[model samples]
Target: MTAAKHIELMSVEDYLAREELALEKSEYLGGYVYAMAGARNAHNLVATRLLVELSKRLEGGPCSAWNSDTKVRVRTNGYTYLYYPDASVVCDPNPGADVYHDRPVLVAEVLSPSTRRSDEGEKRIIYSQLPSMKLYLLLEQDECRVTVYRRTAEAFDLEAYSGLDSVIPLPELGIELPLEPLYRGIENA
Candidate 1:
């Protein structure tokens, strides 16, 4: 559960073979595996809602929606192998070996207390390096907040939103998300 426990020498295949039955979330470090904690009900609920809405909207588009079970491999030269995101959308349908993509057009992470900082920090940094990544999104499990990053020629621009009626326009996928369906069953709902 600490820095020392994370091993950095296991091959991607070896890591997968060892922890295939893991009940909780597990991250594949360069060569070792680390157990990931569970997300709260709100976190999982929102992730489900977002995926549902995204799937419905992206049905006929070229992009495909991937739930968390997919593992994302961020190209690390030789430093590290993969880093998983909660949800992702890819323009390509024929992603090889990896179901989770490093070339994703868009990636979404549902925030939990333990991972909010990582999703915003280390994970964000790792994702930014992907050439095909266009938008990186953070979904709030504690509130109705959503932060989006769009790739521009010079840099990735940031757009943050809250409450209902704030539309998330995913141009590549030709879809827009309104807050209504995303925050469907919270206490305030």
Candidate 2:
């Protein structure tokens, strides 16, 4: 029976402006902004290992790997979203001067207890919507496990690998990540 609440929806420009001054990174979806959670040691270690490996392998090539701070802009069904993956690889020769990357060939997320559901569900759906995404990796921080979603002609195929001997191959980037090295610094606590 009371008057409905009215709130001003934040535009992408407004979000970008706040991002510069804010202490922490946030994800913008449509008109809502959500603060990012801090990562634990295992999460950071895994993400760093992957980023370092990808960066080392992609050196001097047309492709480049980025850390989690790089934002990826996605527009799906009339809604604009800005998300930061744990690691991303962009193969574009001339990516325009934007604060976010829209043409990432690979996006990887190191799964934590706080982000598992959203990463596996919402993020999986959104990242796949991008035509430039060739591979999406979800890595477990507690164990040596990886879930890869590879894009085919019209859909994505799922693959899982575990143990220290498995190697994840990404033909798109002409590189392979061995499970041992990726999980080298992580420890169970």
TM-score of each: 0.88, 0.94
lDDT per residue as tens, model 2, 44-134: 9889988988999889888999888889888999999999999999987235556789888999999998999999999989989888999
TM-score of candidate 1 relative to the true fold: 0.88
lDDT of 1 by residue, 1-84 (tens): 657675357787777776576667678766667778877889888898888888888898778888888877776667665666
- Could you give the C-alpha RMSD of every candidate to the true structure, in order shown? 3.6, 1.7
Distance from true location, Cα of 76 in model 2, Å: 1.5
* Model 1, global lDDT: 0.80
* Most lDDT-accurate candidate: 2
Clashing pairs in 2: none
CA lDDT for candidate 2? 0.90
Q: Which residue window of length 10 is worst by lDDT in model 2?
A: 91-100
lDDT of each: 0.80, 0.90
Model 2: what TM-score? 0.94
